[model samples]
Target: MAAGMLAGQVALVTGTGGGLGQAIALALANAGARAAITEMPDRLPLAEQTAAQMRAAGGEALALPLDVTDLTTIQAAVDGAAEAFGGRIDVLVNNAGINVRQPAFDVTEDAWDSVLAVNLKGLFFTAQRVGRRMRDQRPAGGCIINVASIMGLIGYRDRAAYCASKGGVVNLSRALAFEWAAHDIRVNALCPTFVRTPLTAPLLDDPVAGGDILRRTPLGRLATPEDVAAAALYLASPGARMVTGQALTVDGGWLAV
Candidate 1:
């Protein structure tokens, strides 16, 4: 890989077994950042495969097991990535998330808890641990990209828990950015409108839901993982050095109306 914008940097991306997390990790590695790809223990094999692909393309990469919901695992994963990447992590992508689609009136307490546990709660603790590491690192600066959703910025049916969790993520990124600015830590949220990933393919394949989404988007199409990955790349690159505490949307004009 030729030296790219992120050359010599180290990035830790969670939930890299597939989907947006995998795409972002590959993009960062291809851009010359050493990547630490992490996933749940059961998904470690898939993450390893992703790392292998990066390595085959001449990019430095490693796969680690991480369960964001568990504080012990979050700390361990952060420490492991930092240790593996020369004791510093230049970028952190808080991408581990889950959604339980159901009407607000029908949403069970368990469902809400599970969604928030992985989406909002997990993301917060992971960012907290990584932010601390970034603050104390010799350079005393780094970037954090939280993968929020356009649903976070707008209302939608059967997504009450998801929307609530992602909304928290958007605001949380801003709060963290404000508090960490003095440490030179830039925090931002990447809100992508309905990307076609494995986790979302079923919904996208539904004629009713899918058609409605396409109609609402001025661009007339759903987002691809790469579309969101590109935005994440910019946030992690030197080009966005002055950018912080903002929600960058890859919604294809979904909110234009």
Candidate 2:
């Protein structure tokens, strides 16, 4: 069990239905933040599970159905979290994203649109809604952590759209961090290499391509969701009060190599 650093705060982690999102949500809750775990209502279940686990551990948590792509849902989730807690939202982890990897030319327009809609397009509007609410709050603004990918820092074959979207995310965080300083909102980004997640399970299961990835990571092992969680915790905690617009990489030294 990691030590608590947040102690007293309200955090919302999007895409909390599973994998990296669930890990971050649990870590925040354990650290004494009243975490709101959000996921789409239909498919994934990590949000409720994470919320329940936190409650059992004597931490405050809320599981709300949220699709980050839907502005209406985004507003409702943020509003609901504030209402359930103390009309305050101290942190928001923008971890919800979608990616489709295929040869650049072979990728369909729908695939490209789908990835951008959730990963890049929706994020701007979602952040806007929360930023406004946080700004309006008295004497206290909020922090926003965008979960980007190493793909943002480097190019990968068959991931042109993904690279572009995440690259946008990285820059957006930097720009927003500078612009929102006056409002006391600190914005940053978390960039990780291809961590093993359900989204990548099918690909990794194919022994041929999976072995190639393991060789690229200098750490000699693929990262788990918990690994990324630790990084997120640092940026979300008071320990990082001065940090903003930074893209902290949690990849297994993939960039170093």
Candidate 3:
């Protein structure tokens, strides 16, 4: 077998049943990391599909159903990745989140709570659980990449819930990095602009909002799932060993102008 930067490492990527999550998982495996995917049962098919693809590519892949909001389930899934691969879980990519795009005034308490539960609370707990385990392991370290959004750095109409959640992800990555540095774990965030994924597919069909997104982006286009995947790959690999607590933007200059 040929050697790569991530040779012999195991990676667990959440929400990878499809879209950006699957892309990240596939790319990580391609780079030599045995990959694992976590998603809710009956919610996503991409997790199994992505794992199968990785296996065919000659990479070890594990697919486990999970709910990031459920601490117990997530914890077990994290440990399972290590056990299944017969090695330590060297990377965790928190790619699960919900984007709510309703008018701020119309955003109900239920909407707020639902989004926060999954997007914020779920994200934090997953990191904490997986990070602690990694801290205690033989290698004594790992990488955590939280998927944020450009909305975290800026604002948009009808995206109050999304903005808040992603903003939380961005800052939480930094806070985790500070606390986990002593444990040899690196924490970082990826803030991508509106990417073409199932979550964003509806927006692309929306005549007004979709057009507006393209106009505002200096790249004059939306980012693809592959773009975010590349960013996740770099941060998870040894190439980003020195990088931590950064909300690396991959929005095609959406924030630049």
Scored by TM-score, the top model is: 1
RMSD of 2: 1.5
User: How displaced is residue 71 in candidate 1, in Å?
Assistant: 0.6
Q: Is candidate 1 or candidate 2 better by TM-score?
A: 1
**What lDDT is reached at residue 13 by model 1?**
99
How many clashing residue pairs appear in each of the predictions shown? 0, 1, 2
Give the per-residue lDDT of model 1 (tens digit) for 7-104: 88999999999999999999899899999999999989999999999999998899999998899999899999999989999999999999888999
lDDT of each structure?
0.93, 0.87, 0.87
User: What are the per-model C-alpha RMSD values against the true structure?
Assistant: 1.2, 1.5, 1.7
lDDT of model 2, residue 84: 90
Clashing pairs in 3: 17-46, 17-47
Native-to-model Cα distance after best TM-score fit, residue 200 in candidate 1, in Å: 1.0
- Give the alpha carbon lDDT tens digit for every residue of 1-257 in model 3: 12476888888899988788888888888889988898897764768888888888788888998897777888788878878987588899989888777999899998898899998899999888888878889969999999988888998998899899989999999999999999999999999988878888998899898999999998898888888888988898777889999999998898888
Over 4 Å off, model 1: 1-3
Q: What is candidate 2's lDDT per residue for 163-246, written digit by digit as tens?
A: 999999999999999989899999999998777788888778879778877888899888889899988888988889899999
